[model samples]
Target: MQHKNTIKLLFLAGITMLLASCANDDDTAFTPMEFTTPTYETNLELLLGDTLKLNQEILNLPENVQFKWTTEDTVLSILQNLEYIPKQAKTFALTFKATTNLDSISRTYQVKVNDPYDVYYRPKSSESSSLISQVLAYNPAPGQFINSSFGTPEDAQKLVGSTTNTISLGAWGGSILVGFDHTIENVADAKDFLVYGNAFNGLSEPGIVQVSFDTNGNGLADDTFYELRGSAHADAATLTNYTTTYTNPGMHADVPWLDSLNTAGSVVVNSYHPQNFYPLFITELEEVSYTGTRVFPVVSNSGFTNIAALEWGYVDNYDADYATYKGNLLDIDQAIDADGNSVNLRGIDFIRIYTGAQVNAGALGELSTEIRGIADFSMLE
Candidate 1:
């Protein structure tokens, strides 16, 4: 009787072990919840006021899972899909979460909303001239002609109606803003505009050109400006968002300037230009600041210092006589945004030109850009 009781105990112990092994196998076979999508990051882009649908198909999640989408403190959607329309141009960070009883998964999306396309058609009137009709703004950095010849806002107006008149944009960052009565179309496979400057064979003071559209129909150049990508634009030496501040020395002296790179320099005073280098028209502020793209100039000193011209895409940059129509021709298709990405602009209503170099050529003084006039190329065609 004792042996039978022992045998029964052993059998019961074996059965219990078998049941535990089966339970372990079941747990091992269970699959963990995970996103089946190939990539974890998603990017969506749309224009402002346009509906962007975020369908559940993008998740590739399993059925019976709960979904939640949130941006900041606001819950965008609790459903499996979302339809969003942005009111303004900005970026939005969105989070999508899927949860079940035992597992959860999440994803992030960056939604970039851009402004709607606004194109200003050219006017049909025969009286409209291809040249710029108005001077919107002018600000010249400290240079030889700041207070003497071409620093004031009124000096920018001289180039409006005639190709013979000229204005000097003082040393680096000096800029002029001008607008046309009609928009200049970006014709395919052809240059769109011409900018006349005093650039000749051995003297080239290139100016960075930027274009803007009247997106709001406000008849103002208050919209975003895109830089025209020049030959040096892709060069690693080129600097973007460069800033220089000029401090008034209170006399006709070397204009001291500090740059964003923590470097310091001066717009050396020359005997030919005895007037103050600092702009005198700006009385409200003692110091002036200017910022834009800066290019590297190749300065060679033989008998005289000569600044070499870039291949193309800059005002006051030398070009072959046949390639120019009394000025340097520019293509509107080369427009680029702040991030160095190319942008397709239908047309432009305003143009801004700024001195792009900051070299002080020994006795020649500071390098400056001189603009005679700007004209729409379609008129010539």
Candidate 2:
């Protein structure tokens, strides 16, 4: 009986020791797993001409780790080697994403760039409601078929100038020089100014618009002028470097014009607008000459044939309608040197628009390209 009690006591002690070992195993298994990801700064400030360097070192990321960087500003020029350079003054938002075997993380950075040139001139606030501040000159000659009143010199301001209200232009090569109270800056990577004209369904009257900078700082418009070439300037149907001469019809005769192709057309007298299309500024001139790009006018059995709206880059396009007008946006980058190479311009002070097409729409009379108003493109945005 003594020996049996001794064996049972030893077995109970062994069982206690086994339970304690199982408890130790449970405590060791309960430890949680941990995860980690890379991080970086979330804000940055830059100047107009400064460059931002992007690399794993700046991010304090581990070596051999791959990451991606991107920005929302189109004006920024990104180098293939990983540099962010802003071309203009604006706030840019950048995103950086990094991933690892265990997890991934993302961060955003706000970059504000300051403009060195600052705001030289503020555009008129009321683009659609504002009238052209000034009209410097008006020149229109009568067409053999197109005879209408160009109004007086005072009336000329209302004649080819831009307005939110309805206005008319003397048919033929009626040209006008319009000015603004402030200069128009050449915005980077964006359109500078917009040309508002009268374009209806299937009928588009194109005009040649030119720009000039106050380079001489003379406040006057005697500076060099650059033509804002339109979309049709390069069309195979267009006549580039073309020249045409118009001889005055005198007091009561038809106007005649001759083109480079020797294809002659007459401006016939129509009963539409009673005012003579000839300019009151110039008279009894032997001949008037026009040299530049010309857009072809369409005439069909149903009336004027529809001129397809260009993708962009032309004034008086189909977008000129009152309901859809968004200023015909033009970029200063489109300017070209006399050799046809691109020319860089800082800003413009004066604007000139001329009747670009020598087209007659039969009963419609001469295609009188009309202007409603001009506005800085930024105003629409």
**Top model by lDDT, which number?**
1
Which candidate comes out best when scored by TM-score? 1
lDDT of 2: 0.62
TM-score of each: 0.71, 0.59
Tell me the deviation in Å of residue 60 in model 1. 35
User: What's model 1's lDDT at 74?
Assistant: 84
Q: How close is candidate 2 to the true structure, as a TM-score?
A: 0.59
Residue 351 displacement in candidate 2 (angstroms): 0.9
lDDT of each: 0.83, 0.62
**Which residue runs does candidate 2 get wrong by more than 4 Å?**
1-131, 141-152, 159-162, 165-173, 297-299, 303-308, 320-323
Give the poorly placed runs of model 1, Cα more than 4 Å off. 1-119, 321-323
Worst 10 residues of 1 by lDDT: 116-125
Residue 363 lDDT (model 2) = 63
Candidate RMSDs in Å, in order, are: 9.5, 17.7
How displaced is residue 270 in candidate 2, in Å? 0.8
